[model samples]
Target: MAMEASMVKAVIFDKDGTLFDFTATWGPWTADLLRDLADDAAHADRLARAVGFDLSTCRFDPASPVIAGTPGDSARALEAALPGMTLDAIVRILIERSRDVVPAPAVPLAPLLSELTDRGLALAVVTNDAEGPALEQLDGHAHHFAFIAGCDSGHGAKPDPDPLLAAARALGHAAEDCIMVGDSLHDIRAAHAAGMRALGVLTGPATELPGAEAVLPDIGHLPRWLDATT
Candidate 1:
């Protein structure tokens, strides 16, 4: 079937899961954080549970706020497990640790992004992460994005249209001429609220997103969609 018509001038992506493989990138970080911050094994378990992560499996549950929330949200969740740590301290640690993370791309990023750009499509990222760490993670590939914003970037987070709208403006495109691609419901909701089209991918924990126009295996398929639609 034909997808959207050839009107999309910009593409806004969700960072963690859409661009990179979320679990492969963040599972170790969360596990280490739990163990390091917790006083003991039981405490680690509490921290894990608080964030909806599995210590044994090193996997995040589908509903984990960290999967689609800001660093502040995750920090507050962790604070419930660590009585001694203030939200500020946890956020600092998260940002510090996040700065060094090695991202595992969901697909080859350079070529994919280049393909989209080569087609004259403006690209941007709107994520629930902090601006600092999100930039750090995308350092080498940052050139492909015309704009990048996180929750702390003053645009607000996903499930809200502000950030997406901001990115669209930065990319110099109208909301109707853009698409938001991500791996969660938050992405779809943001796109809908912003009046852009939405596409869902399976690189993240969300296997189904009822709000998306279509769900594909990963971003590798995006070019095809663009081709068909355009």
Candidate 2:
């Protein structure tokens, strides 16, 4: 199970679901953000209809290419409720609240990240979160990444190749040389679109997504798979 630095130039991680528990990391913040969105004149009524103060299952739709996890559903619901608000404004609010939501070390990140870095494999995070919270999680880690790319930092979010491509470039590596580990189809789709290999981790439950190079139980098994041919 030892990992070799030569096998992986860099490891690109999907933040919310893969590196950290999506529900544990984002659930409370999402609830608060949705409540705030509900208070807004533009979104209050619509958000009430979507989830009615319950934030657990209130995600953007699973069908949309623009959306990713259940967290995105709340975001999308807010956007739907508020017709004319700029995407920038909505993303800004979500990102700010996410700063208070911290990832649990129980998710098993420190050692793997340190091991990867120790082996000289560059580490980067490519997430759908806007710039603010993305940086917040990275900042909370005493170990730093070579690059961190957020949705607001580029042309588009997950399922789009831009953010993934940007992360690879920031690491000074080719997309083909990076291993993208995530918990959603959007992560798989984005990595594939960028010509990279992806590993899907079922930190939540089983999903019907296809296209990733492999799927693992969680981040704990990821490092060993960097050289996996399957």
Identify the candidate with maximal lDDT.
Answer: 1
**Where in model 1 is the C-alpha error above 4 Å?**
1-6
TM-score of every model versus the real structure: 0.96, 0.77
Clashing residue pairs, candidate 1?
A: none
Tens digits of per-residue lDDT, candidate 2, 1-230, equal 12222346778888776777755665566556656766564454456455433344644333432236323544665676767676567656665667788675425566777887887888888877776667767675635587787776755788788888888888899877887888788888787788787778876333654776667878887666764652
lDDT of each residue in 1-230, candidate 1, tens digit only: 12354488999999999999999999988888779888899988988999999989889999998999888889988887777778898899988888877899999999999999999999999999989889989999999999999899999998999999999899998898999999999999888888889999999988788878889999999999877876
Instruction: Name the lDDT of candidate 1.
Output: 0.90
Q: Give the least accurate 10-residue stretch of model 2, judged by summed lDDT.
A: 58-67
Query: Would you list the C-alpha lDDT of every candidate in the order shown?
Result: 0.90, 0.67
